[model samples]
Target: MTTNSTEKRAVRTSVLRASFLYADGATRLTDKYHTSPIKIAKSFPLKDQLAVIVMDASPGLLEGDCYELDWQAREFSHAYITNQSYMKVHPSSTSEEAMGSSISQTFRLGDNAIIEHMPEPVMLYKDAKLHSTTSVHLGPGSVWMQAEVICPGRTLRNEQFQYAELRSSLSVYYGDELIFAQRQRVVPGQHQLAAPGCWGEMTHMASFCLFTDQLTSSQIGLIKQLVDDLPATGDHQVVVGISETERYGLVAVAASTAAWPLQEAMRYLWNHARNIVLRKESVYFMYS
Candidate 1:
């Protein structure tokens, strides 16, 4: 037995069942068969935006567990997936006294389809490292949605993720046409941590909402209501904003104290989007 006090990293892979599909202006997800108990991943559509629910996947993460996520949207459909809380990444010191995790996500959208996946924040521990890559392929007339946050590893633990590294890259393609590309890298000891507004005044930072469909007056009103209900946690605050984008799209921005607030913001937007889309069917209250 190794003398190291830290527990040996646990290696786990949960092949979560497929949890996505599209309906008439709505996405239907049936959890009838879940091999992994309550850790369910389901997605639905809110107008042109996607609303996904990943139940049982809480804020904290287990060591040596590589979680795999998947998604699919039908034609003219949209969905966004969110976690209940922040994603906790424990320290795993292997190979040269360093550790990290990798998240790989791929999307397939149909013509006029759209997807917005805004999960909770990933909390890093001291010396923790992470690499996340997302690929998006859109059908003709289709749009894509996304958002993410990188917090300064467990700031409350007095152990800042010193010597940490994080790399995130995203590639979006619309019908054989590459549209967007963005990449970010943050290495604590090597990069500038206090370069005046690099990460702002707070040690914990988070962002939300990648993309939204057409920004109609109805949608704006719904967003307004959602923002107004934002909660306050004394030290953390969630800020909301919207901007006009090309393709008649409206980009919604949700910046929060951490991943928790961002998730709350996404939930609000998802609910509002759902109501607006369903209202058109007379199935719910008209969002006029």
Candidate 2:
């Protein structure tokens, strides 16, 4: 794997790679590799599946820092991957050139394999810049679910939308055919994100994507009902929309004035999708 940083100066570069395989009756961490600031914190068995957490030792991503992560789930294997804390992007100094920070992730799933990737929200500090990309490849009968939340900035400090720039891209391919692709760029100074066609009055946003062949019309209806039941009052208010992709998948997006509403909505949809596709119950994650 290669770092995606374009900085000319020396910076921290790290990589974490892991592979999960199924044998006998359970999925196991077959092979793993990692570098500084990012490593597999631990793994625990969840029935017949496995749950792994990746931790970043550093406080946050600094200017010119780059991280690469790759994971593969073998045929029939099931695994859930998550992060320990928020993906905090530190600000770049105005006195020097801003190389910013970047993170690249790749996931591959074999036939009938299942992977649930649920990372914490991303926090952008004032004047921070970040570039993130995720690529996924799915085999026949496989299922992949990913949820992401993005914060404008430190809202408590009245620094909302103060980031210099944020670029994010996601591409999902079923075998050799591309089924879904999304690209987003946010530069507060250049765009009116609060406009009607943009983010409007929302300050935080979240996205949940589920790719599976087991989705049925009944399941989709149930998911919609779950979203409709969310509170739309006071601090719990959230605007959510769910739609099916061109292929075998669905995407749900939510926006709110705060992060908690969006997180709650996404989690609800995530758990519902897991039950429909994997015939498994929700397993709550404990965050420190």
Candidate 3:
């Protein structure tokens, strides 16, 4: 609820809180509440499971806009959340008067529950400023999969890294112990994000985190090998790397100037990881 320059900028905030319950051998959307500019729709064929599509009623994020979201998956239930389209952060006003937008999402996964919080890439316009945070709290025997993608700007329009600032963080906790964490802050022209050791010449970067329990050393090696084998080819070059976290989790990073290649790489990783976790293939539909 706190914002900067409230007097000079018009604050547009939208909030959505929802919970999923398991009963009668199926999951139900037990609780749902949303404010302006944010809505949730369960339009998929899986009524027993919750597949929610987050709809943004507004044109896009504007200066001084803030979004707050909270989602919960009760014990033994499954939930999947996706967005309708790519998030667009438009340009702000003058440098002195420019305002930054923020988004915060919190997820609670109960024991034996599963939740997937995957959304489309965020496109930042020239001089756009944005900050986002995602917090996940997991119970014993629960699984939470999350990923994030950020693009510098529209490449076709020749607006690469013209944004003012971008800051984001993701934290996963299991019973008050932080199992995995990722953080990034980039201020174009001021930050050396394109250096040889950094993103280099890449314009888009993505990260994925998988939090589960008790993975053997061989499994972790297999996951890393899968990531290293993905081909970065054909007009959209991408480079990806994967490693095991200290807490029996997996972290994957991919970079590409084009969004599609990075997304493809993530999809491959997720499918392979799921096979390792569940011992079988599962359906995960991701589309633009």
Q: What do the candidate models score in CA lDDT, each in turn?
A: 0.56, 0.87, 0.82
Return the TM-score for each candidate structure.
Answer: 0.65, 0.93, 0.92
- Model 2 scores a C-alpha lDDT of 0.87
**Deviating ranges (above 4 Å) for candidate 1:** 1-19, 23-26, 30-52, 55-65, 77-80, 94-99, 141-143, 161-163, 209-288
Q: What's the residue-level lDDT of 273 in candidate 1? A: 52
Clashes of each: 10, 0, 0
- Model 2 CA deviation exceeding 4 Å by range: 1-7, 95-97, 231-234, 286-288
Judging by lDDT against the true structure, name the best candidate.
2
> What digit string (tens of lDDT, one per residue) describes model 2 on residues 5-99?
54365667899999999999999999999999999999999766899999999988998889999999999999999999899999975534677
lDDT of 3: 0.82
Winner of 1 and 2 under lDDT: 2
Distance from true location, Cα of 211 in model 3, Å: 0.8
Q: Residue 150 of model 2: what lDDT? A: 93
Write model 3 residue lDDT over 28-91, tens digit each, in one string: 8889999988889553534335788999888788888899999999899888788999999988
**Which regions in candidate 3 have their CA more than 4 angstroms from the true location?**
1-7, 45-48, 231-233
lDDT of 1 by residue, 214-272 (tens): 44666656655666776665667766666544432445655555555665555555545
Looking at model 1, the pairs that clash are 49-78, 50-78, 50-79, 50-80, 51-79, 51-80, 52-80, 112-141, 124-153, 146-210
Candidate number of the best TM-score: 2
